[model samples]
Target chain A: MEHLDALENQSIYILREAYKKFKKLAMLWSIGKDSTVLLWLARKAFFGHCPIPLVHIDTSYKIPAMIAFRDQLAREWSLRLIVGQNTAALADGMGPERGRLTCCTALKTEGLQLLMAERGFTGLILGIRRDEEGTRAKERYFSPRDKHFEWNYKDQPPELWDQFKTDFDADTHIRIHPLLHWTEIDVWEYIRREAIPIIDLYFAKDGERYRSLGCWPCTGRVKSNAATVEEIIAELRATNTSERAGRAQDHEDTYAMQKLRAKGYM
Target chain B: MATDIATPRASSNIVIVGHVDHGKSTLVGRLFYDTDSLPEGRYAAVARVCEETGKPFEFAFLLDALEEERDQGITIDTARARFHTARRDYVLIDAPGHKEFLKNMVSGAAAADAALLLIDAAEGVQEQSRRHGYLLHLLGIRQVVVVINKMDLVGYRQRAFADVRRAYLDFLAALGVHPQAVVPVSAREGDNIAAASARMPWYDGPTVVEALDAFAARPSREHLPLRFPVQDVYKFDHRRIIAGRVEAGAIAEGDTILFTPSGHRGVVKSIERWHPSRTGPARAGESIGITLTEQLFIERGEVISHLADAPRAGAELRANLFWLGDRHLAPGRPYVLKLATQEVPCAAAGVSGVINTATLEHVAAHEVAKNEVATVTLALKTPVAYDCFTDIVETGRFVLVDGYDVAGGGIVLPPVEDDYTI
Candidate 1:
C-alpha cells in the first residue's frame, strides 16, 4: 500500500505541476494500461475533472476493441477528447506493407506532430516507463524536444531533484512523463489497487492475452490465463516475460526503440 | 495471502555509485541475477547478443541496454532496474562512475532513498570514489551501505576488505556519512552477494542482499511543521479551489493556513476531493485542493504553513551547491532560482570553499567549474519563503536555472553572518 501510495502521490504531484505550468497542455492516451492509469491520476489530481485535453492519434489500424474502449471511456468520463489521424497518409494507402518504422513515423509520430502544430499544444504528457525500454531508461521526467521534435538524448539537460526543465524557448516542445518511475509490475499492481478499468483484451481469452497493446497489425499476444487484474499481478510476479514481449515493433532491430523515441515516437 | 500477492510491497530506490572499473555494474548485475530478477528471455537475449559479437558473456553485459554502451563495454548513463526480495522490492539505480558522467550520477543519486557505495578491494580507494561519497553527503543521502567489491581478486581475504573499508569509512565519516553496513562482495564470483560467502570465514556480517533490506525508507514527514506550497488556483464551476501538495504536515478543514512572503492568511473552508464527498485531513504527499473561508489573492510560489511556524523569508541565503553546467558558476552571474514553486532571478553573491571532490581539498577559486561541488551564497532579487534543508527538505532544496537548463542544485543552509559582495 505504501508503495502504491508513493507512486500515486508522486504522479499526482507531477500532473498538478504540469497542469499549473503549461497553459496549452494535453495528455496522450494510447488506450493502454499505463496511459489509462495516467488518465485516472489526472482526474484524481483535478478532483474528478480532467482539466487537460486528451489527445489520441488514431492510426485507424488499431484493433476495433481499442477504439470501442476509447469511445466508451470518452463518453462515460465526459473527457475532452481530441482524436487526430494521418488522414493523408492513410489516404495514400500507407500500411504495414510499408516499412514498420516509416509507417509508425508517418502515422504516429508525424501524426502527433501535425496534431501539435494544429492545436499549438506546448506541453504533452505521456505515460512512458523507464523499465519498458533502454532508451526510455535514460529519460528525464520533464524532457524537452527541439523545434524539429527530436529528443536530444546525447546531451540532455541535467534534471536534479524535483526541479525539472520546465522553461524552454517558445518553439521548444516539452514532454512530461509522470509515470517514468513506475515499473511494468507496478502498473499492474496499481491497476489492481485502484481497480481502474482497462480494455478486456488484456485479459486472457482462450489461452491468449495482449501483454502490451498497440496498433492491430503490429501487435501480438502471448499465451496467458490472466483473466483478471489479480491474476495478471500473480502472472507478472511468477513469469519472466518482459511486458513488451508481445509488442512487435520493438523486435525489428536492436535499437528500434531508441531510434523510434529519438524521432519522437512516444 | 491473495491480497498480499495482489498488492505490491513497499519499495526503495537504492543507488550504486563508485569509481569507474570498480565493479558497480557487475555488482548490480549480480544482485539481479542472484535474486532471479532478470527475466529469462532477457538473460538469454543478452547472451545471444554476446555470442553474435564473439565476446564472452559477462554479468555487466546484462545491463548494457544501449548498443553504443555495449560496444564500449561501459555504462555511460544512469539506468534503473527492479529486483525484489521476500521483504520488499528495490529499484536499483546503476550510476556511471566515470568523471565525465558525474551529472548522470547526481541525477540518479538525487532520487534515491539510500545508496550503496562500492569500492574495489584490490585497488583500494580511488579518486572518483571519494568524489561520489562527497556528492552523496552533499545530496543529503543519509543511508549508505559500503560494498568492497572484487574481493575474489584479492583471494577473498578479510585484510583487503578491512583496509579499503577503514579508509573509505574515515573519509565518509568526515562528511558525516556513517554507512549502515560495510559489505565484502565479489560480484563476479558471487561471493557475499545473495548470501554470506563461505570463503570469508574470518568475516562475519550480513550479505549484500540482507544489508539492502535493512536500509529503511525515508522517514515520514507527516509530523513535521506544515509547508504546503500553493501550486495553482482553479475555479471549477463556482467554487474557488486552491491546489497544492502537502509537502511536510497535514491540513484539515477549519485549519488556518498562512501563505508566506505575501503575509496573507485564510481558514480552510472545505477539503476538496474528486468524489466531493470524501472529506478528510490531507497528509504529506497528498495532492489536494481546498476552498478557503476567505478568497485570498495568493499567487503561485508562496509557501503555505502555520503562521506560528512559517519558513524563513529573506532575499539571501547560503547553500551547499553542486554545479553541473558547462559554464563556470561565478559571482554576479544572473540565474533563475527555483525553490519549491517559487522562481526568481538570483546571482551568486559569493562562491567560496570550492572543493576538489577528488582530493577532498578546498581549492581557491572564484568560480565553480563543471561537475564541481562548492558552497555558495545566493542573492535573490526579492524575498521568498524557505526552510533549512536540514529541517524540511521539500521546501529547502532548490535548483539554479541557467537559460532553460537546470545547471545546479543545492540545499538551503543556515544564513551566514558575513556579508556577500554583490
Candidate 2:
C-alpha cells in the first residue's frame, strides 16, 4: 500500500545521487508519459529547475504534436534542450517504409548514438521500466552501455541493495534507469497524482489515443475514451494488455527487443 | 485459498526453483494458465509441438522450447513469466535447478522478492534442492516457501510431506534461509495449484497462492541515514538537477547532502517528489531529481548523503563472494568492480578466504572455484562509496565484471562477526 511513496522516494533519491555522481551527464527524453514524468522529477529534484541537458533524439518522423509539445515545455521550463538526429540516414531515404526494426535503429538508436558521440556524453538517463519488457526486467538501475553502445543483456551484474555497477572503462557510457522499478500503471497513477503535463496524443482525439508513444509512422493508436490520466490508470488496472502494445519492433520476433538492445538500440 | 483482494498491485518477483524434472516450469505454467496471464493462444501451439515431437503435453511446455531443452526435457536459461493474484502481480522467474545452469539460477534468484522452492514428494530432496537453497541463502534471499510437489504420487500423504519438510529445513538452516511455510501440491493432475486439493484434508495451511499473498513484504526503513545513488544529473538553462532513488530514509528542504567517491557537498535547496505541477516533500522509491545548494563534483553512481551522517568509509571492503562466472576468481586479477552506478577497476587482492557454502564454515582457501561461495577482501584502484551489504543491501551489494560480462556478484556482509557464518 505504501509502495507508491516508497517508489517516489527512491526515484527522488536516485535523481539526487546521479546529480552528485557524474559530472558530464545528460538525460534521454522520449516525450512519453514516463520520461516526461522523469522530466517532472528532474524539476522536483532540482527544485523547479532542470539543470542537465534534456536530449531528445529527433527521428524527424515523430508526431508533429510531440515536437510542438516538446518545444513548448522546453521553453516553459527553460530546459537546455538538445535535438539529436541521424540526418544522413534520413537523406538516404530510410523510413518505417523499409522495416520497423531498421527504421527504429537508424533513427532512435543510431541517431542517439551519433549524438552521444558528438557531444561526448558519458552518462545518459532513461525512463525505461523493468515491467515494460522481459529483457528490461533483468536490467540494473545503473546499467552500462559499452563503447559500441551494446547492452549485453544476458550477462548483467548483480545489483544487491542499491549498489549499482556504475563505473565502466573510458568511452563506455552508463545508462541510468531510475524508473526501472516502476510499472506502467504506476506511471499513469503518478501522472495523475503529479498532474504532469503530457501531449494531447495520450488523450482520445476522435476516439483513438496513443497508448504508447513512438515514431509517428510506427506508433499505433488504441481505442479508448480514457480522456484523463485517472481514466488511463483505471483502464490499465482492468486489463492485462502489454504497455508496449503500440511499439512495432518488439513484435517482429520473440526476442527482437533483446536483439535490438544488444545492437545498442535503446 | 483465493481472495479477490487487490492492494494497489505493486510488483513482486517470485523465482520458481526445483530439481530437474521436478516440474518447476510446469508449476509456473499452470499458474500462468490458471491466472489467465498467458499470451492467449500460445498454449495450443505448445500442445501441437508436444504432439509433433512425441513429447507429452504438459505445463512445462510453456517455455520457448529450445532445441536442447526439447531434447532433454529440461529448462536451460532462467525463463520468466508473469501472473497476477488478486492481491498483487507476480513476475515469476523460472530457474533451472540443474548444476550446469547454476549461473542462470543465481541470476534469477538475485531479482526475486521471495522464492518458491519446489521439491518433488516422490524424489524427496535432491542435490539441486540443497544447492539452490544454499545459493539463495548466500545471495541473501530471506523469504522462502517450500512446495512439496507431486503430492498425488504419494496421495498427498501427511507423513511423507512432514519427512521431506523436516529434512529440507535442516538443509535450509545450514544455508541460513528458513522456510516460512510448507505447502503440499502436485504440479500434474491439477492438485492444489490454483485451487486447494481434496486429498489433503488433515493439513491446514494457506495454499501456494494464499501463502504468496500472506508472504511478508520487505519493510522499508525511513530512519536510516539518507543514502541516494546519483543516477543522472540534468542541467537545464541555469539550474542543475540531481536525480536518484532513495535507498533508505527521507529528505526534505535545507537538508545538507554530500556526494561520495566524488566527495561533493551541498544543501538541499528544495524537496520535490516526482509531481511536476505541485512540488512537495519526497519519500523513498520515487525516481525524482534534487537541487543542491552549490554545484559539486556530482555524477552517476556515487552515493549522496546528508552531511550529518557519513556511511562507513572504506575504499577496501571485505565481501561475501558468490562466483557465477565461467572463469575462476583469483587474487591480483584485475576486473571491474561495480557499486551503485560507479564502476572501477578492482583486484581480488588477498583472497583472505572462501566460505564452504555446504557447511557455512570458513575454509581458509585462496583459490575460488566457479559456482562456489567465498569470503574475500577486495581492493579497488579507485575508492568508491559503499556500505556493508547488511547495513544497506541496496548500496552495499556489488557485481564484478570481467571484460564486458558480469562475472560475479557479492554482498558486503557485515564485517564477519567472529569469522563464523552460515
- lDDT (0 to 1) per candidate: 0.87, 0.76
TM-scores, each model vs. reference: 0.96, 0.80
User: After best superposition, candidate 1 residue A55: deviation in angstroms?
Assistant: 1.3
Worst 10 residues of 1 chain B by lDDT: B413-422
**Ten contiguous residues with the weakest lDDT in model 2 chain B:** B1-10
Residues B314-375 of candidate 1: C-alpha lDDT, one tens digit per residue = 99979989898999999988899999989999999998789888777888998999988888
Alpha-carbon RMSD to native, per candidate:
2.3, 5.1
Evaluate model 1: give its TM-score: 0.96
| CA shift of A118, model 2, Å | 3.5
Instruction: Indicate the residue-level lDDT of B52 in model 1.
Output: 81
Best-performing candidate as measured by TM-score: 1
The true-versus-predicted C-alpha distance at residue A225 of model 2, in Å, is 1.9
Q: What DockQ, between 0 and 1, does each candidate earn?
A: 0.65, 0.23
Residue B232 of model 2 has an lDDT of 73
lDDT of 1: 0.87
Tens digit of lDDT per residue, candidate 2, span A109-180? Answer: 899999999999888899988667656655667778888899765455545445455557897888888887
